[model samples]
Target: MFFFLSSLPELFVTVNRQPRGRICFSFLWVEGGRRGPCNPTAFAMEQLSTANTRFALDLFHTLNEKNPTGNIFISPISISSALAMVFLGTRGTTAAQVSKAFYFNTVEEIHSRFQSLNADINKRGAPYILKLANRLYGEKTYNFLPEFLASTQKMYGAELTSVDFQHASEDARKVINEWVKGQTEGKIPELLVTGVVDNMTKLVLVNAIYFKGNWQEKFMKEATADASFRLNKKDTKTVKMMYQKKKFPYGYIQDLKCRVLELPYQGEELSMVILLPDDIEDESTGLKKMEEQLTLEKLHEWTKRENLALIEVNVHLPRFKLEESYNLNSHLAHLGVEDLFNSKADLSGMSGARDLFISKIVHKSFVEVNEEGTEAAAATAGIATFCMLMPEENFRADHPFIFFIRHNPSTNILFLGRLSSP
Candidate 1:
């Protein structure tokens, strides 16, 4: 959820949910086309995906550093897409900051190519339901530039709906929230909190999305049993360990001394990649070493297709769920993106004047992992180990590990998080 409730020209927001058990999130405030250079051979989606993933890792590091020992789950696609929409209606420093914050500047013709990328990501007929939605709202009296409106609508597929925020802020909030709730299939009933919309509100932009995580080779519930998950060298917690053994794309990064496992979803178009480090008995040999080397270049080198090989693996994963919310104003400021949220902002692209600025940005996310997966999992409960010297195939996530959901084709990361204490 990325909420854009500003005390300025307009409000922007969005929500996300997945299938079966859904991911519920809403942004009360509102919300890339581009091929990047540097790698001229790459497609626009590839370049944008690189930028998105780079931002995802940066945001993950920031959040993890803020709360090192807690569970984290956020939709990088949701946040990045939402912010890109908002930045669509901005120019000058406001645009520069947003571009810099997300590394969109590296991409050429970012808005148009981003539209293509977003549209491709949301295409129907996938094995599971995962979609990104966009819409716009404005105060009945406020006048917005046709250029901004047309650009946002064409680029993000957002259709503007006029609401009387000046006279009926409460009613407007309820309407917007209900719309978001309906869009999320009632997953988020209250997207716009009471005080988020008031007399000063002039416009709003909202987005919604749905996602599903169905494993291509799911864990067996029968094989799953309570196991000890080490919080660190000194502390451990009991967790239901999901067990599975099958051939998957696996790799070993000697530099970080970690094993990477790619677990595809039902369609094989999306996957969850896990990074598990060797456990150390003494000292805090946690994810610090792994995190230290997590640069975009290194990540690309580590996860590239050529670097991995299909191999049989004994996978032991903990079934966990996480919900995280963050006010991105401070974090964006730390990234030198403070203009959009403060009075010094310039968003003349939206209203043809300098009356608009993003006041607040709140993001909330939820996700769960269990033994359940695609319908095929029930039929084959493949349950099972590895020896040293040969190719390593035993993957044990008994301690803290890093994982991210990735769109296979474009290499865009959908979600990035870690199980610190789970």
Candidate 2:
């Protein structure tokens, strides 16, 4: 199911689904507001985006340390959306821990910023398909607070659904998975498995994001050829390499020793930025080193419109596909969110009593890049600088590199990945 915002004023679409294929739709009149550009200097979304970027980089480094030789793909927005809903119902130390770890200042700030961003992206006339969905599934007998449900719908556009997890956990799993699958256009079919949700589970928060778009400047299919992509300084493998030479918004940083390139999508609202290290080193380690020196201030100084030069670049990027799933419980625990998963978790704000704690955070992502464009989807359940210049401006991504699909207006990263061998 999708949403369309037309010229008609004040419309709220609420879709509630029960166990099995039962779906009920309700529409409410929502008053419209003054439409204007969100000022970057004062808006909470910009500040949140900056803080979230740092957190995303930190998480990327953590994941990189764990899997040195493998590929990495994740959606911070997806995971954060799920956890943000959980954050709405936290208090005291639990809330403080999660707020600091997730880069959220307050529950209201998180909710408002997300609501504004969602409204901006969901506007009509967008040339691509970008869908974001959130759902809260509670056991039939669990008495979730009314304020919690109202806040989720008002701020995050999420709806609560009652499922029979108390008696049939397997069936509840299927119901949630089917909703996730529909949200991601089947790119993420199975997000929850047998043991993830059980009879004891009181609540499960899930978020899914899907994006598909063609390139603003399409690459020629005939130019794509087999080329050797260096896995490391010593190892190499031949892969299908896509070639495109165009004048893109590009920049260089001497301190970090990397080149930045931004390739816009058809709508120009979102784009893919790639960072290629100057040396042919392990991309994971290279990425970690670069990430260490990265600050939001320095990133702004580098990628700022006045800083980048639209130089013609010979780009040779390998065509690749990646689909990966991760259980973020341990990762969040390691990152100082230790209270939420254990007995110390204080989720009293979700329910009147202190009875709710996060059970599992299941995240899965899929991405495909070819000559035409990109198709990527991600689902989450409860979860750089430089200066430089010089010789040839050829960005031959024959080695490992980092890439991000970000919304240009809000500067929110929808997807982040590393192409190690692909």
Candidate 3:
């Protein structure tokens, strides 16, 4: 019974992380309006559902690799709903009508699923997970983007006079930052850091995701000390690394030539574990094997009825920061969401006869790890979903160790990162 409750969070996270099937169209409802035949509300809701599921799944998969262990928490509904509204771009009567027309049976179902998952985690004494999804049903914000832009012009010291919704401008960027700060509990920083918003910006969608949790087995500060860290084969540096030795629920398994380790978190609801190849000589093959075998199904099977042991192990990890920015227009296009990026795509429910289409998609993520724990922030923006496929590099994070922010029952990953040195 103890093990069953402990494994629940991973189960929930895993289920949430699984790639979803095509959305069922039966839930959408269309109504007559000045925009001709528009269903922006339905479209927005559907998109939110799909994005939330995908984000939850991707986060888990990335975090639950070999070599690290940690915690992850998030408000998936909040981030997904915010992104959906920005994409819809509804205004005035059309906005109000579309809001009324949109129904959320699917959202309710997801809430129910999360609630059940949370209950299992709570049984294991994990922090209560709160989604805060009601913001979506509240008053809309993007409808006022025009007014917000006008105010920006008046406040600007310069005589910048151009203000159009089709192209996102500096003024547009300011509006988005203000909105994001209000929604994300001030977790995200500089949302539009690259001046990606402008007047030609017909639609702007933003999602801010945050995760915070306590470690199951907290590391003692006295155990932390300076150590040597290898950045690569030729470069080695000395840095502070935290160390801990305890009896832990650990697993060692070989999947396609890589040794995967499972480190259970407190309450056994979640875990922070890592996978490293036995043959570090062939780093490329090791990373490929790890990725191929990294899935919720295999993880679930592995953790079920596992062996427990008290092992004397020295763990050293550094405090590090990572920030990355990506343009996701190309990624979304590859994902079959191309219509929202084209003129032919109908977003009439947002505004009457508005020739609106997404022009860009941007993503930024940051992570910090120290003796205390881990902190991370990520944001995704879609103006017009285009296509950009970056080359995949070998996942050779052959440093000290890696950590993952994960929910135990669902195995949903909030974040995944590595700590090379202190």
- What is candidate 1's TM-score against the reference? 0.85
lDDT of 3 at 261: 44
The TM-score that candidate 3 achieves is 0.55
| RMSD for each of the candidates | 8.2, 8.1, 15.5
Ranking by lDDT: 1, 2, 3
- Model 1 worst lDDT window (10 residues): 375-384
Which portions of model 1 show Cα errors greater than 4 Å? 1-42, 280-285, 374-392
State model 1's lDDT.
0.67
User: How does each model score on lDDT?
Assistant: 0.67, 0.66, 0.36
Model 3: per-residue lDDT, tens digit, 1-422? Answer: 00000000110000000121000000000011112237554444343333344554344344334223222223333223332343244344433332332222234343333333323323433452222211111112224244333322232110122234343346554654554454334544345444343332333333344433445566688876666655444556766666665444434443344333444544455455555444434332224445444444454343332332334334444545555343434443443345444443444444334454444444445555555554454402221121221222122223533345545444444444434342
lDDT of 2 by residue, 25-77 (tens): 11100001222476433456666676567667767777776886678887776
TM-score-superior candidate, 1 or 3:
1
What would the TM-scores of all predictions be? 0.85, 0.85, 0.55
Clashing pairs in 2: 253-386, 253-387, 254-386, 254-387
